[model samples]
Target: MRVLLVEDNGDFALPCRQLLAALRGVQVVQTAASAQEACDWLRANPGGWDLVVVDLFLGQGHGFTVLRECAGRPPLQRAVVLSAYADETARQYARKAGADAFFSKTNEMDALLAYCLQLAGEVDGANR
Candidate 1:
């Protein structure tokens, strides 16, 4: 499954990338720093990405715009919000905006990937 990781934090990006790299069947893993870049990439790579993992707080304005831009696309239906801000509002907004899952950056990324794998049927989900 091709995945796009939209995270601005370098520290978090590396380990996440490493973990995804270890997982099998994840063909294209691209990382973008901002909402604009992500939106542009998505438009250019439609039907190319299976999932988009985005951060709610992009250190800029609302990152919801990125999700909004991709929500209408068929292949972009699978999305997850990975953010450091673990607020109810953010979670609610992400869910309402069509995020398949909401994950705090501090949580186990394996769980996030497992969730994605489950939603996409590309890899083993964490279902015991």
Candidate 2:
């Protein structure tokens, strides 16, 4: 499974890559630091990506715009919000904006890993 991780902070981005590296058949194809960058990638690649892990706050633009860019993605493609701002309001807005799931960075790292693992399993199974 290919992933596009949209995170501007180096600290969080490194850890995220580390965690995702442990999963078999999962590769982070690219990392975008801003909403425009992510949107550009999406437009350039269309179905090139299988998953997008987005952080709400970016250095140059908001993750919400990135999420909006992911609207009407393919069935196998998913967009998830992995952010520090995982409050109820954020969750609701993320869902409305087009995130397939929302996971808090501070406390939900395990959940994020599990979600990725599940997708990897499905992808692996289908490939088999």
Candidate 3:
């Protein structure tokens, strides 16, 4: 499986890479610090990526805007939102924008991993 992470913080991006690498199926992991960078990368890869993990507050452009773009593209629809700002309103926005899952950095890491695995179609989140 291939995954793309759009995160600006080095601390968060590093751990996300390690976690994706640790997963059994995930082999290729890519990172982009900004939404525009991610958009460009995805354009090059075009339906080649398995999943996309995006931060809600990207320090500049909003993740929702990127997701909106993804929704317009074909099956570029496998997306998840990961951020410290996991409020109900934010979650609703993500869901409306076509996110498969929404997670908080403060939540249990295991649960987050399980959710990601499920989103990647490797495992079932409901089984956890």
Candidate 4:
């Protein structure tokens, strides 16, 4: 599973990268710190990524923009929002934008990992 992670904070990004790297079937993990960078990367890679994990509050711009950028992705490709500010409004907005799932950084880390694992298993099954 190839993942593009959009996050501004090094503190959060590092752990996320490490965790994803340790997961089975996660072959590549890329990082984009801002909305422009994320959008640019998404455009450049078209249907290259299997999954995108985005943070709502970025250093510049927002994850909603990134989600919008991913709106045209193939159905097999997935985007998820992982935010510190994962309130009801944010979750609804993310869903409306294009996010397949939303996870709170404070309390839903396990759920996020579980979702990723499920996606990875699917990818593995497809490859088999």
lDDT of 1 at 98: 77
What's the true lDDT of residue 74 in model 3? Answer: 46
Give per-residue CA lDDT, model 4, range 8-45, as digits (tens): 99998999988887888785557999999999999999
TM-score of 3: 0.85
Candidate 4 residue 44 C-alpha distance from true site, Å: 0.7
Query: 21-108, model 3: which lDDT tens digit per residue?
Result: 7887665457888888887888888766777888888876878866775775545347888889988999999999988788888885
lDDT values of the candidates? 0.76, 0.91, 0.77, 0.91
Evaluated against the true structure, the overall lDDT of model 4 is 0.91
What's the CA error at residue 86 for candidate 1, in Å? 1.7
* TM-scores of the candidates in the order shown: 0.84, 0.95, 0.85, 0.96
> Sorted on TM-score, highest at the top, how do the candidates line up?
4, 2, 3, 1
For candidate 4, give the lDDT of residue 78: 95
Candidate 2 per-residue lDDT, tens place, 1-128, comes to 89999999998798898788778888999999889999999999997888899999998999999999988887778999999999999999999999999999999999998999899888778769
The model with the greater lDDT, 2 or 3, is 2
Give the top-scoring candidate (TM-score): 4
RMSD of candidate 4 to the truth, in angstroms, is 1.0
- What are the per-residue Cα lDDT tens digits for candidate 1 across 75-121? 43578888888689889989888787888877656688777666555
Worst 10 residues of 1 by lDDT: 119-128
